[model samples]
Target: MKKETRHRATIIDVAKRAGVSKSTVARVLGGSPNISEEAAERVHAAVSATGYEPNHLAVGMRSGRSGLLGLVIPDIANPFWADVARGAQDQAAKEGMSLLVFSSDWDSAKEAAHLRALRQARVDGAIINPVADNLDGLDRFGMPFVLIGSSAESFPDTSSVGSDIAQGVRLGMDVLLAHGHAQPAFILGPKSKLARARFLRAINQHCIERDIDPASLHTEDSDYTVEGGKEAMSRLLERASKGRHLAVFCANDLMALGAILAVRDAGLRCPEDVSILGFDGIPSGAFSWPALTTIEKDGRKIGSTTVTCLFDEMAGRPEHGRVYIPCRLIERGSLANLLAGNTDRLAAGR
Candidate 1:
């Protein structure tokens, strides 16, 4: 067989076509600021014409900037976290940077290990959603980094991009209260400080705004899992004696779906026996039996924006700031207006 010939373009070809020195081409490729505007235009024109892509590894080695961002997430399997990762990944790629991810699995040891690895790799920056309560350990890390999703209020040294969960909770509660739910039940996540703090702040704020007693709102904390939601809901159903129609707001969608099942298991119907609202608009939540009413946290936006923030930080720009992505409420059939009859059924399972 004849030797296979590749048609890939090289930097020399671009340099020749642009009538610029190879050094100029290298500077342009490395995003060096010393290059002139006219030279950059010519190099860009040549690049577009030849479809030439620079070798990232070679460029990184020369510049001493790996152009690599290390992203550490608490739990990759959770749809909420998945959204965040996706956003960060897309943004990093858009900036011509690579993302190196490490799943902490909600384990502190694993998180610490990942941080050490990132530092060992000498990454340009990190975007970490810390697994531990305080990421004080990361302070010793010399690389630039941003915190995504979760924030430790006590530790304000790092930059972050996160959701306004308190706002999400407030919105969910407002919708429920407006629908005539006098007493609402909360399905919370694990004992993370941020989770607990968000719930407490939102509940207090909502109660004050609605002129309702804070003690009237019922709360149950569990792991950020479907089973946790189920167990927590079961306990709430037991306490929901005297035919009181409960409006339940879950911390996350998985828990909300679990609560929906628990409500059904308790010989009650959703939006009929109770109104259910969930957080994190995971796609599965929309396809659940009754279609879950949830707060849509734009994971795509969060992920992409976090990457942008990380890149900005890496550039030594004035970007040490916190970004809060607003939550949107998706109205589904799960929330029922106060009526004496039990009605509504889940859609066919996907």
Candidate 2:
């Protein structure tokens, strides 16, 4: 049997078929301003006829641009991160660039490896949601990068876009306190992370300003998962006494949902027994039994803004030091006013 040989089309073939010079074909394909309308039309027609595919790798090599961007996130399972990925992807497409996402699973070692891989792939730039507080070697990568949802202290010089975590936490606390919950507990993420540390610090500051004993505040660390939230809530319940209007402010909606579940599992009611407040306003929070009242942070906007900053840096634009997206309080069913003696306001509308 004879082996079949495949034929590949080239720019030379396109130029020959278009009855134009190779330089004219190159200009038309490269979107050069020197090309005439007629020449462009002829080049496109020849490309269709000859099925010529431009060698992007060769072009990128000569131009020193990969036209690719990287997004490093800690978790892909979380809906917040998923929304962020979508927003970044949308923005990337608008700029005629491609995005590659890497999930480090909140591991510092994996995060570092992913950064190394992105640099090796020669991506034009990157937006990273760092997993650790110390980003010591990030500058050595020599690629322009923007931090998203990471603490300001992590990468002081890099442009960053994130929700105002401290403000969000304070909002949640104020709401609970206004509703007459005096001793609100906190379900925190790992304190080692900057985001969590900021949250804890904000809670402490709020307590100090209110003349509440800082040592009286209860805090439990969790992994930011539903199960982790449930476990943290359960631990709090063990120390909680009955007849007290207890409230818990969770770091994120997932944990808040878990806390609600734990409350129910303990043969108690949400908002009636223990009010729950969450951050990150994820869609799932709305569908929960007692819809979560949360601090709404637009993850999509954060992602888009981070990418915009990264592209700006890539284009030699002046760095925007730190961009903080504001958070809004979305009142829902999960949080209730204990002093009002009516749970009507805690309806599932946000």
Candidate 3:
């Protein structure tokens, strides 16, 4: 015996069962305020009786809105990005929309491909943390997009949400200088990113203002991972001068944690022998062996704000331009007062 295939119920079936026009059913499903209560009740009753489900794709085709948002980031493994994704997801849920997140792993080609996929998926908008400053194909994709943690120079008209990198750097430098360190070494990220460039500029400006020779400041680039931080910190230790206390500032918390380990491997204690600071304010920093002092960028707030900007753009609201979130200094045990004279001599140099 052959089994009969059941046909799926559509909005038309519900409308026919309810003895109402298709337009009335559409308005009821779309939650139009203009729909009368009697019509809405009939549509709901018919929908239940017919077991009809709205096809989101068909609705989107007619309405030009998919009720979906795409979020693209470099690395999802990083705790900072994880927090960012969570925040964005929460906000999207509150707005009656769904979020689709993608990790590009810092690959420019992959990032572009993800953008294309988002367009094909008909996402209402997108928020991207680009792999690099180049966004040549973004405008041609014909979707409204917001940049997160990126520079305004490349896409000046695009909306963005990020912390003030210069202010954060200045705050960290002030803390180091207050502790009697004339010049602090830097564990910076790759120069291709705007964050690193802004940080480098801020550190140089800070040194110059304090009458410290900017050239005297030791700097090393890393891949923004704990291992990369460890390697960079180890190299800095090998070349450091003798009889001087060393203060270091890392681009992010993961790097700072690795730097602390490097200090220990070199037979030096954090704060007592070497002072370190980091950025991003990741939660793990608070629970590390020696709590990390960092420039708090508030990834959650940045994510939520980016979503808000994208929603506003989708609603045809006036563009507010770039939004700069302020960064704060979170002082913790990782940084020590060199002025207290508890510094110990290092085996390598100082």
Clashes of 1: 6
Per-residue lDDT over 112-191 for candidate 3, one digit per residue giving the tens place of the 0 to 100 score? 89988999999999998877787676677578888887555467677888888888989999988888877789999987
| Candidates in order: C-alpha RMSD to true structure | 5.1, 3.7, 3.9
Give model 2's TM-score versus the native structure.
0.89
RMSD of 2: 3.7
- lDDT comparing candidate 2 with the true structure: 0.87
C-alpha local distance difference test of each model: 0.82, 0.87, 0.87
Note the residue pairs that clash in candidate 3: none
| Candidate 2, residue 263: how far the Cα is off, in Å | 1.5
Number of the top lDDT candidate:
2
Summing lDDT over every window of 10 consecutive residues in candidate 1, give the lowest-scoring window. Answer: 341-350
The digit string of per-residue lDDT tens for model 2 on 1-350 reads 99998789999999999999998998888889987888899999999998898876778898999889999998999999999999999999999888999999988889889988998889999988888677676677679988887555577677898898878878888898899877889899986777788888888898889999978889899988999999999999999976565789999989999999999999888887789999999999999988899999999998888888898999899989889998999998988787786654443221
Candidate 3 weakest ten by summed lDDT: 341-350
Q: Which digits, one per residue and each the tens of the lDDT, describe model 1 over residues 1-350?
A: 89998789999999999999988998897789999999999999999999998876676777788778898898888887887878788888878778898899888899888989988887898888877666556667678887876554345666778888778878888787777776787887766657676777888888888798988778899998899999999999888865556788888899999999998887777777778898899989989879999999998888888787777777788865678889999999899876333332331221
After TM-score superposition, the amount by which residue 232's alpha carbon in candidate 2 deviates from its true location, in angstroms, is 0.6
Backbone N/Cα/C clashes per model: 6, 0, 0
